[model samples]
Target: MSFLDKMFASIGIGAAKVDTILANDRLVAGDEVNGRIVIQGGKIDQDVDDIYLKVMTSYEQEIDDKKVHKECVVGKFRLTERFTIKAKEKREVPFSFELPIDTPISYGKTRVWVETGLDIKNAIDPSDRDYIEVHPSPLMSKVFNAVTDLGFRLREVECEAAPFHARRRLPFVQEFEFVPTKGEFRGRLDELEIIFLETNRNYLELLIQVDRKARSIGGLLSEMLNLDETNLRLTITNDNAHNIKDMLYQVIKKYS
Candidate 1:
């Protein structure tokens, strides 16, 4: 190769490009995502050291008392080992990975996407980003329906930096916020916040926080300090999906 050709490829001019095609972009949490990576060679041959995929999302973090969104990887996987593409070559590699069960749903400002990248020595790495729509798992879907059934409206949803006690495999947690509009707890509780802690084919685990309405000056002060919030960890199984509304009502009522 000529020196000019190498220099141009190193700067990503006439360098190999990559694109990812997903079989289905709309899927529920825990589902297997199938896709293929397409690499198209440019004017010169290139040796790729490796191929990688990252499941990415953003979360709100308070830096200097200012809330800003930052990117975080939920999962990463490898597609292939070192490979060489000849000039003007076209290559396709199939790949599949299980979506992390705790992946934040594409609700509110939360977005999830797959990032495919090619690692090249002494050359700019080319990457492709494809956004996907993730839905709640079956049992988790039931939980949301139950909350709405109880006359609660989804007010806001966001993925926030996880507290030390709540951190799992991920540094952040997706929180679903709800407000009582026409229920018994409407006058008693201020709001409800829920986080999906874990999920499996058989069950869904959740951390629920109940914010009660302040009744006095002391209560108001406690609320401001986040002391009046009650946290509960509940697990709903496939068997409980049918009675989720009553089960949720009973549990939340105890706290509200």
Candidate 2:
């Protein structure tokens, strides 16, 4: 290539570009995502220090008392070590990694994606992105399904900024909100907001805040300010997964 061509390539113009190709974009948390990075060489050979991928998601973060969307890297992995890409050559590298058990599910207003970039010496790096649909783990789905079995309607689900009280691997947490339309909680509880702390092989942890409906003038004022709620801690095992409703009912009853 001509000197001019090399100079432009050094500045990232017409440089090697990368794209991630996943076997299947839709997957549940705790499952392995298999993909290959296809790198198409540009005008000149380039020495790459490394190629890496990051699992990213957007979260709500409060800044200056206002909420803003912030992109966060939930997990990362290096695809390869030092390598050289010959001019006009194309290369592919395969990779597989488990999505974190706590990875946020792709639901209303929530998104997940994989981003890839090359670490090159003395040259601008090239990057690519592939969005994915992440679903809940089997254990998490069972818990949510139990809520429905108990007649609680799934009202809303969203990725929210993690408050100080929430301890999580990511900066944000997803909350599933539900309202009991029929059952013991119908009149006593207004809604319940739950954050799945995590789901391990042995147990699942949940942080729940149950909101109560207003009874009188004083109660109404507290509800408006979001002050009338009961917080509960719950842990369920594989054994209890089958009877999650009963466990939830007992906990709600104690607060009710």
Candidate 3:
């Protein structure tokens, strides 16, 4: 017998097997995941002590000039079901659990994946990994579309490691980079970095970093603005080459 077979035999599992089945094939953050554990016994009866379920995620982190592996336990459960399995007998146990809302999107189309596993004592552990596509909230999509409609095209999107204090409920921040397509500030500015906070009460917080190009005389100027201000005003100009034409007009008009 192989070493694994010997180990299984020592655990009193002559030929035990474990399988997991989910009620739905797809899941989203904040959704309940329901499934069943199927256990098939071998030639000898075995006493099961405990069962455990764990949810894990694999992500990359930069450490000391190199990328390293980081695995986190998002969730875990200690099952209370205990029983004795007769020779050649089968048993099934049902389980239901909730997925956390703050789960990070790790795949395309804002999707996140979760790996679920069953730890069967004295036997080999069985696990399953699946993808969950996260649909952007209506408010989120609205704000995104609004920015695009304002002549800003998306240049890049990424998740930041640091948590921002402007809004709550986010352990990781998502940044969207855009280039101006029209208006007075077009070529004058490099790109805009935008961060969206949590959606609440039909409103969302937009954090913007405006990068200004260097002037011919050799000095560069950049500014950060908070979009939540009510009294803030800017003139809307139709200059196609200047992306921040409207902003510049407003500033110039205010000073004049």
Using TM-score, give the best candidate's number: 1
TM-score against truth, every candidate: 0.96, 0.92, 0.60
Q: Pick the winner on TM-score between candidates 2 and 3.
A: 2
Give one digit per residue, the lDDT tens place, for model 3 in 25-136.
4655556878887778766555676666665554444679886655555567666566776767988878888766545444322335545444455665444566555544
Rank order (by lDDT, best first): 1, 2, 3
lDDT of each: 0.91, 0.86, 0.55
If ranked by TM-score, best first, what sequence of candidates would result?
Answer: 1, 2, 3
Deviation of model 3 at 186, angstroms: 4.1
Top lDDT hit:
1
Residue 196 of model 3 has an lDDT of 54
Per-residue error (Å), model 2, residue 43: 0.8
lDDT of 2 by residue, 86-113 (tens): 8889999999999877788888788899
Candidate 2: regions farther than 4 A off: none
Q: What is the C-alpha RMSD of each candidate to the true structure, in Å?
A: 1.3, 1.8, 8.3
Report the poorest 10 consecutive residues by lDDT, candidate 2.
162-171
